[model samples]
Target: MDAFIGAYLGVLTLPNVSDLDGELLIHVGVGRTVGIWRARHPGDARALFLFRSELGYHHHGVPRQKELLRGAFAGMHAHAHRWVYELDRTPAFYFDSITQLRMDRTSLG
Candidate 1:
């Protein structure tokens, strides 16, 4: 964690970041990660599509848009859009972890 933080802050001397295969949870509203991502992928239609898809996924089939949006984006350590790659094929892969995490957090609190 410290190494990744140092690398993100540009205060660490490290090799290629490409070798790191793990995911990093980032807050979209704060810090430089969003800017860095945008800068690195200017005019990328794929990124735009991904953002729209995530937005649509979380709010789809819901009438209470306000509450749904609040639950999706607010009161979390990491506030960002979450995308599950497989919606129809293998939803359990994503929801299982999501359920466990929510349960763990609720229990912890």
Candidate 2:
């Protein structure tokens, strides 16, 4: 995972990010990637990822990460976007829920 994250970080420039956003709907899975990044490179992940407050909604102290995960599924139905990247090894339930969002086995090269 560290190696993957390191390679991704190597190419994670602002212009590349913009191009990625233009092509696909991306969502960070509520998992160890952020924690690992924070531990490995403190203060850097904060700049790259968005927080709950940035989404312009008040959670009233409820855990917002859970809401964000739920919202990812909700947004799939509410919106017409066909692609979403759950930036982790996605689980089976995800595949069961959304049939169209298949895993792309093609290389990034």
Candidate 3:
């Protein structure tokens, strides 16, 4: 592997997350990206990327971030928007569930 991206939030559940080669991706700011693969597949669970901290505090203190995330996947399948209070503290990560996201410590500032 290139290097284990720290799971500051958690681990990746989706097997193909590391290889978004043929998927259509969307820039979600904060230097993060969301590859839309199974956005709204009827009964399938929707997936999106996140900055570990955003997933950790989605309901605690980031409403605007939540709104932006929701807006990003509004008609599709985004859960919420993630914003940071400390820009320098933000870490690169991907959301797999509501409680946590797949984190990469090496990608952090």
Candidate 4:
């Protein structure tokens, strides 16, 4: 597995997080790759590869991320963008284009 993917998998294995309200949302940004992962089954966590866009590359803008993710999800669905691995069933992980990039280390074990 890729280094980032391995890191994400490791993060998912840590005990159950109570604040997710029955869902797990993960956001990752590495160079041109930025994505959010949702874990439907607590144990079904998996990494997803997302396409990056240079046209809109702002960081941490919740609204922009939401819009971009919504549009990306829609476009992906239309284009049959299916993940090879099982991920969260809910679609809550959104990418914003204009928000500050906070280093959330709480999720890292």
1-109: candidate 3 lDDT, tens digit per residue = 2323322221112323324444554545443444434323232222354433333333333445434444433343242222221122333323332433454565755
Give each model's whole-structure lDDT: 0.23, 0.26, 0.35, 0.35
**Predicted candidate 1 versus true structure: per-residue lDDT over 1-109, tens digit per residue:** 1111111111111222222233333345322221112212232111111111122233233234323333443443332222211122221211100111123243554
Misplaced by over 4 Å in model 2 are 1-56, 73-109
Q: What value of lDDT does candidate 2 attain over all alpha carbons?
A: 0.26
Alpha carbon lDDT at 74, candidate 3: 39
Candidate 2 lDDT over 3-88, as tens digits, reads 11111110121112222321343345432112112212322221122222224333233234334544443443221111123322
Candidate 1 — which pairs collide? none
Residues 1-88 of candidate 4 have per-residue lDDT tens digits of 1112211111111222223344434333442232234356663433333544555454455455434444444433321223311123
Tell me which of candidates 1 and 3 scores higher on lDDT: 3
Q: Identify the candidate with maximal TM-score.
A: 4
As for TM-score, the candidate ahead, 1 or 3, is: 3
Ranking by TM-score: 4, 3, 2, 1
Lowest-lDDT window of 10 residues in candidate 1? 44-53
Q: Point out the worst 10-residue segment of candidate 2 by lDDT.
A: 2-11
Clashes per candidate (backbone, < 3 Å): 0, 0, 8, 10
**Weakest lDDT window of 10 consecutive positions for candidate 3:** 79-88
Candidate 4: give the clashing pairs.
38-88, 39-88, 40-88, 59-99, 60-99, 61-98, 61-99, 65-95, 65-96, 65-97
Question: Each prediction's TM-score against the native?
Answer: 0.18, 0.18, 0.25, 0.30
